[model samples]
Target chain A: MITIEFIPFSQMSGLSTEQKIKKILKSVKSDKIVLLQGKLKKDEETELIKLTMSMVNEKFHGIEPAIFSPEIKNTGNFLKFLKEKFINMLLSDRQGITLVGPANLIKEIKRDPEKMQLLLDLNVSRRKKK
Target chain B: MLDKIRSALKSLFSGFFKKKKQLKLGLYGPPNGGKTTLANKICKDWLGEEMGSVSNIPHETREIKIKEQILIKSGNKQLTFNLVDTPGIATRIDYEDFVKAGLDEEEAKTRAKEATKGVIDSIKWLDSVDAVVVVLDATKDPLNQVNITILGNLQAKKIPVLIVGNKIDLKRADIKKIENTFPQYKVVGISAKYGTSVEDFYTELFNLVKP
Candidate 1:
């Protein structure tokens, strides 16, 4: 069975970049998809990918990550855009949803400004059955 | 009149002595998207030297390679810069994928490890570059996450970007799809292998790095 875990921003608050990555990686390694309450900082995202690479093994492949920031839709409204940008600067964690899943389980994560489509690898279930 | 002549001479002498800051131009994209091929082509055209090897296997470039002081002449104007060819960025790397590409299990595992480091290094190098050339396969779907992530990061950093739709020699190549996918950036289509439309790429480079 596929497991999805929601991690609110409060849980990730006050954590260092490495700690946040470790927390996410721990869940991914356990075969659970992580639904993070807010997006990671740009550098943290890169670090997450880097850490994920080092931990790649026979059992754990890696991660497929996608972020959906609400600010993307506000681009058309100049005042709204400025307001969102200002708010983002004040907040410790930018408001958004970040999805991270084990690469072995998630085939693809297609994203646009409006929505995200997560495609699962049906072959994984077939292998499990065998 | 004498003072004006002295001033003119001083200006000319200063222009001759002043060195322009070398622009760092990076080639980035997904694995097997012909980034190394284009780097080699650019190097050969100006310096008569190749930067790195090329292979059909993905992640052939597992480390960042650079060639310095490449001067390209277009008409009477010349542009010189350091060319950085980075390993392709990907969301995932699997040793079994390498094994399927003809590598032994152990070799595949090692390659995968190096490739992961390569991706990290590529992302880090984004901070240091002045401008970037996003090399992509014209034949493949241009809307993949790897391409989006690379472009998004570049955008966030406000780095000047020029997209190159490579491998136009192939029948399946579709530069239009890439152009439509990214209407915000300038897209140039070329076959980095056969040197097709490469001159146009050089012309675009001049515009891309204009101060």
Candidate 2:
């Protein structure tokens, strides 16, 4: 089982997103298995997507939502895409959870229907990691 | 083809029985946001009827409800409100029944898993309605995702919206904060449980919609 805990920048206050995620993965018992995807080097997106798909195929459903940064480009968008990919793989496959950002942030995004619509398409909320 | 003919016949006859234009207006908000309560108050005081059902549970309204509605005009020139109530958006809906609901599900779920599928569906519905009555719960944290989404999408689509901030009877209800957060909306606070401010709400609604 995996849990994607969104570290809302506001909640995390001073820490950078990568720092918070790195700290989380570092503190957690899971090994190199837990991913850190926001604002990574450009070379990382493909690897992150592949890693996430592999994890889900292994049935590593998330227990909570993963945190992301809006400042982090497609970090949140990518997670949403990952959900579509996972469901495409499972086809009524067991539920999986992947998070985009914190609730408050999601609320902010909600103000922009176009972006929020994208997030819904991405399945960032209900998909396993919040 | 045969079904539509039967439907038109049914409506033609029922129209005589009901004798109302049945203006379709939507009462939309996030889950547990007192949309049903507001709908109930309108049903009782103005419509002179009982509410369909009111519950604290989310997703209680998964489909639309039509009424033998009425339009009461004020002393002004001409205005009326024949209302329709639709399901609240945040409530987890099983669109699998879309076919029964008169739509094809496979085509709809094509957008499934997209974060804003919920928002997209909502935008589409908002367009169908003449005007919108946005409900907010004054008793809870005024800022919520569903309201943000509902209001934002409404604004994006330029749908006429009236913000209903309900449950003012509760001690914790803050009318001003809700007003402040959603300044873009024409906000009103109502104690739907007691029927306070409901008349004015319908009165305002009467002025906005078509007969």
Candidate 3:
């Protein structure tokens, strides 16, 4: 079975950076793929990488990270916010909602609607093999 | 079909024997040290196009930008290489710092996250590079930990490196200090923005990457 969980930006604010990473690690360790909205803060992400690298060993398939920018919502005229719009357009490939989890559990990732669509496909393919 | 197969076999044999002539050169440095500026100057002079955008804001290039197959000529010598311009390497990345630079809290956090990833990506790219140009701000102290870490890593890998003291046009710029700090390596100073002494930089790079 493929499991995907989305952690919103607001939900992460209450936890300390270390606690937040530990929480993410717990999910990843349990074979649950995490789709984090707005991405992790820099320090937290660094700490997570350090923890992963230190604990890496047999049975821990390496982490796979993928980022995809979700479409932004705004109510301003396209002409007025042209610069912001252009930056956002360019950033579509640069920044995004980041996903991280064990590689064995995820077959592929696509940056589109149903961000977890690949997981469902993986589950189907695995069932077919069985 | 028989002739095609024979020619293909011949080319495959030639590929195995031919030495790679183009080097994969990386431009690595601390944030705001003008890596992209140097990349732009080199690209403009040779390829007639820019590699990527540049900004006064730190970590503006939060991605690995590449320009391929640039050929540089100096005297009777010629060097052809693929250039990789990496994000500035920093010891610390803070979202609050971005907020101070006039970005909103959410935007600051996003930028910080991307910048951090860029740093890691740059470090990983070191493995694939044939040589490196370690760019430094001529106005800053060259004895800092970040510079040392980068040099130590490059040295450990046994990769050839050329130290560049960029931004020589600034009033506070000092190339002699950089030369004194790293006496073992050849140091060339240049104003990447104005393209000053860039020919010397290219000549030194060709010499450093010589097989």
Candidate 4:
């Protein structure tokens, strides 16, 4: 069976960077795909990848993370650009969605400006046979 | 306040008097993307030496390797920089995969451990690089998360980037697809192994590190 867990930004608002990563890793290790409400900071993403690498074992391979956000185009309008920047600062977490899942389960995650496609390897029985 | 003024003046004078520092050019991409091959080619072309060994297996480069003082000249123009060859970045590393590639169990586990450390090191080195050449396999799909994450991070840092579509000797190689996928950045196609179009790559390098 597969499970998906949604974690809102508020749930991680007060946690330290390490703590947030641990919380996400705990869920991924349990074979649950986490649907985070917003994107992680760039450094946070790097730290998460580093931490995930340390936890890889036979049963737990790693995590595949992807972020989907609206594209910020260059309209060449100064006022509009400033307005967008102001909005981004005000609601950073609400700007995008992040998906993180166990690498063994999620085969690939492809994204473009329009949409994201997640491919899964559902051959559990074959995997068990191996 | 006095210290701040002193530091400001120091920087002002250094900018005018200091010799130009060598640019650090980083080679980054997914595993088995011919990064080492290109590194070897570049090193051999100029220094008559190879940067590191290449293998058919993934994660062959489990540490960052640097080849310093590589100089390339084109007519009256010349550029010199330190070449940084980083391990292939991957979201997953399983020892079983290594075993399947004909490694013993113990060796596979050890390789997996080293590969993880390599990934961490690659991420940390991003802060130190002045420019980057993002090498990609021309035969593979270019829309994967690893490529996106690498490019996004470079964009966020405002680092100058030149994407290389490598392995174009193969029949399935499609450099045009990579070009369309990343229209914002400059893309060059070259077969690092056969030395095809490598001259163009060197020409692009001159523009990549333009001051």
Index of the highest-lDDT prediction: 4
Give one digit per residue, the lDDT tens place, for model 3 in B151-202.
7678878989999999999999999999987888899999999999998998
Identify the CAPRI category of the predicted complex in candidate 4.
medium
Model 4 Cα lDDT, one tens digit per residue, B1-211: 9999999999988986755777899999999999999999999999999989998889999999999999999878988899999999888998999999999999999999999999889988999899999999999988877788888788889889999999999999999999888999999999999999999999999999874
Cα deviation of A95, candidate 3, in Å: 42
Residue B154's lDDT within candidate 3 is 83
* lDDT of all predictions: 0.89, 0.52, 0.76, 0.90
| DockQ score of the complex predicted as candidate 3 | 0.02
Between candidates 1 and 3, name the one with more favorable DockQ. 1
For model 4, name the residue pairs that clash: none
TM-score of chain A of 4: 0.87
Q: In candidate 1, how many Å is residue A74 off? A: 8.2
Which portions of model 1 show Cα errors greater than 4 Å? A71-94, A113-115, A125-130, B1-20
Provide the interface RMSD of candidate 2 in angstroms, 1 decimal place: 11.1
What TM-score would chain A of each candidate receive against the reference chain A? Answer: 0.85, 0.26, 0.62, 0.87
Compare candidates 1 and 2 on TM-score and give the better one: 1
**Cα lDDT tens digits for candidate 4, A39-111:** 8877788788889988888788998899777666669998888888888888886788889999999988877
TM-score of each: 0.84, 0.50, 0.59, 0.89
Residues B89-145, candidate 2: write the lDDT tens digits. 541233333334454667433322221233334444666776788887887756644
Which residue pairs collide, candidate 1? none
